[model samples]
Target: MEGQRSKVSSCSFVSYCFLFWVQLLPLATGGKVPALIVFGDSSVDAGNNNFIPTVARSNFEPYGRDFQGGKPTGRFSNGRVPTDFLSEAFRIKPYIPAYLDPKYNISDFATGVTFASAATGYDNATSEVLSVIPLWKQLEFYKTYQKNLRAYQGETTAKGTISEALHIMSLGTNDFLENYYTSPGRSTEYTPQQYEDFLVGIAGNFIRKLYGLGARKISLGGLPPMGCLPLERTTNVVGGNECVSRYNDVALEFNGKLKKLTTSLNKELPGIRLVFSNPYYSLMHIIRNPAEYGFDSTSVACCATGMFEMGYACSRGGMFSCSDASKYVFWDSFHPSEKTNGIIAAHLVKTALAQFLE
Candidate 1:
């Protein structure tokens, strides 16, 4: 049914790219990915922040201005986030609802749900800094969701469904920003290299835990080039308008470690399929050549001052915002606009999600 989507230019020409895949879903045997369950931070969060007490909330105007019905749903983008469009690729649903949203119907669970929280990360301390849900708590919530699913579909069916579903885990960026660099608790103990390894080790254990829970197709998003984001540029870019080399080096190092960890996990866990979604490279593609993606503004967000305004600063009563969000790559200082999210996800489906779709 996803192919039946109208040629609405408001959603853009890039969306049409998925129509071919959606049409083939019914004909494919195991080729079609059954579901897409997500876990991580704001990059893929739908509306989990609405239920929690955190400044990372995006459940307001301008955030979801381009989404269906024109209402914000806690997605950091001006429209659908990566998970929403990616779900459409599988004909999973128009959008995958948040796991914590009480309004989600029982049937919604059959397809997929996102368990990500804005600003949370692998380090418990990182989440603690923002009062958002910790990675550990998100896992507990997943256990609860599993029980609910079993209750809804009966144990046998739920088991089969979960085993076949695709899982997306994207976290750790905030660990570098909120913990490793700023928090005395972390900086006092480990060097940057040591901290990256520690994060990777803990994250690897988390992947193993998910595998134990019947997640056969698990994909993890690597850290984006944080230094290339608008926020980083505003704060750290020198006269040349170039990315902060130090931060990018850290992201590259962490991504390398992540790839190795996932490879080892795939080898150790029989029947397991682990994918590494390279947000770093995907983002770099756009950041390096914004014109190729049809974006005009990459230096500032579409909301507020667009320079440093994010989270609490981007509000309705105060600062101004751009009229057209599509032209911009970022919706805020730290998060990409919907168009950019779609571009990044299109790359992910071709690269990281290929095995799952096949």
Candidate 2:
């Protein structure tokens, strides 16, 4: 009995020591573990869209008015996007490169971040709406990124070199916004529920691809309330300032299906961490009660046209511009302001990432 007690005690002591050393790993090293690899649409795009000739690009005036030197780095927001905030909160640098940017080379991605440009959606049709980077293309970029990382760090070290790396994904809104609802090309093809399933299937396939690519930490995002966007609210719909319940319902259905898929993925692919950030619920709550979140104008874009009020075809030079970008919740018809993105980043960092990072 005494011998058994001693063995158990020794095992417990060794486990405690191992955990203690693991906890001290970051602090003992002195420098932070760097590198963030982001993949998503406008929400997390740093400046990849600038390289593309798409009309959805945001590398113009009023886009980066809040950045370090007030230069539009191609982010859809006035300043740093969610990826920047997430990197900052994690104590890494803020300027991550867009994977497609010419200035970015293999070395730039070693310590910095990379945003793959795409109107990226769970559905290809949604990706085609604006000719943004499709999910497959984004995965191809990741393949290139991995190759570059391996070349720089060598094969053995590169096996899982993405320590502390976070794959921040913000997509699927375009699937509903452009494909199912607005785009004439796709609207007639699938019912709203069919579209949701199609998107979820795409999402699942994308996640599986990421898992195969050694993406252990993935933050998949759900759609925001589609009906609440200023463009959606003011469009040809009969209602005034009312969110499109049908679109939101589709999003809800997608979220439910996505949750189930995530559960299955976690079980099937052990050691791969996949989390879904429910921005839909959070954004909807804030939009419905702007005062609660300190947002003064949740329904309008701070840019010239102010939401869909400028028509579905509003641009930077449309009509008017707000003096303070922080005062507004959205930068354009389909994008959120830097402040709002920061808020969402904070929530993601605090909630979705709490378990993984710690």
Candidate 3:
């Protein structure tokens, strides 16, 4: 009884701290952020994949069923993703449009835009396999965005917006899962550690390029526990549907090196505020304590058959699609439900965003 009481007290104290930091966030940052610039994979893709001819897309029924107007917006979730929550938290906007979407023009981009594409990664080969936009191509679109911003909002405003914007990069899961593990060629060419180093080097160069283009406040998300995904669990039937420990071990090791890279970059670059946003522990906590986050299920997704359905396979017409997505941690095999994304965004606001904003 005493041990249980102590545990309850500790949890209460942590909750209080989280709420305190959330309340202090806006005041600490002075005013609303100028914009929310994003670059990465399906995690932050917004709706860019809708315009591209790719098999990895979610621009149809059941994808954005929980979002406003009940229309799919190419987001890989049942509703808004983390970047949408981050934009609102920073008082930027409710939604961040895709840079490639024709509906949004220069004025719409002045505040924010995502150049991300679904199924992309730090490795160009990963994007090639899926016929999605590569990170380098995203960078080119960002250059176009800068030019358009300069033309529409004038040079001074464009520079200030780009400098003050909260830039976010979320990639690498596909590099390991979709490319390194699936492709015998990549696996045969380099070991896991070597591949991680290669990806990190590419990430460093990308960040340096963003810095050259006038970005300062940047946050790069570390890899999650890939082994814990429903797809991974289903594929690991030999292990009795358990989370593959070896895959998770690789993620932990990569995150350690990525964190060190961020520290080194902070010292090496002048006036650059770069942060490594880690989601591994937080997502693990939610998976372990789903009841605390109002989730009834964590091991399976809410879409289609729950075990492996994703992208077009997880559709509204599927017979077994869950009636309530809020009860599940994941909407599809690989993406989190809107409720889970909200919880993760809140965690990032307190841990990662606050530090750089301060």
lDDT of each: 0.82, 0.69, 0.85
Ranking of all predicted structures according to TM-score, beginning with the best and ending with the worst: 1, 3, 2
The residue-by-residue lDDT of candidate 2 on 40-154, one tens digit each, is 7777777777777677777766567667676667777767777776665565665577887787787878765665664667677667777778878888878878888899989
Q: What is the lDDT of residue 175 in candidate 3?
A: 93
**Per-prediction count of colliding residue pairs?**
0, 5, 0
Q: Tens digits of per-residue lDDT for model 3 on 152-258?
A: 98999889888888899999999999999999878998999999999999999999999999999999899988899999999998999888889999999999989
User: Which is superior by TM-score, 2 or 3?
Assistant: 3
TM-score of each: 0.93, 0.85, 0.92
Which candidate wins on TM-score? Answer: 1
Q: lDDT score, residue 150, model 1? A: 91
lDDT of 1 by residue, 241-327 (tens): 657788899999999999999899989999998988898988888888989878888887788877877776766522377766777
| lDDT, model 1 | 0.82
Candidate 1: give the clashing pairs. none
- Candidate 3 Cα errors over 4 Å, as ranges: 1-24, 27-32
Which 10 consecutive residues of model 3 have the lowest summed lDDT? 1-10
After superposition, candidate 2 runs with Cα above 4 Å error: 1-34, 309-319
**Segments of candidate 1 deviating more than 4 angstroms:** 1-10, 17-31, 237-239, 316-319
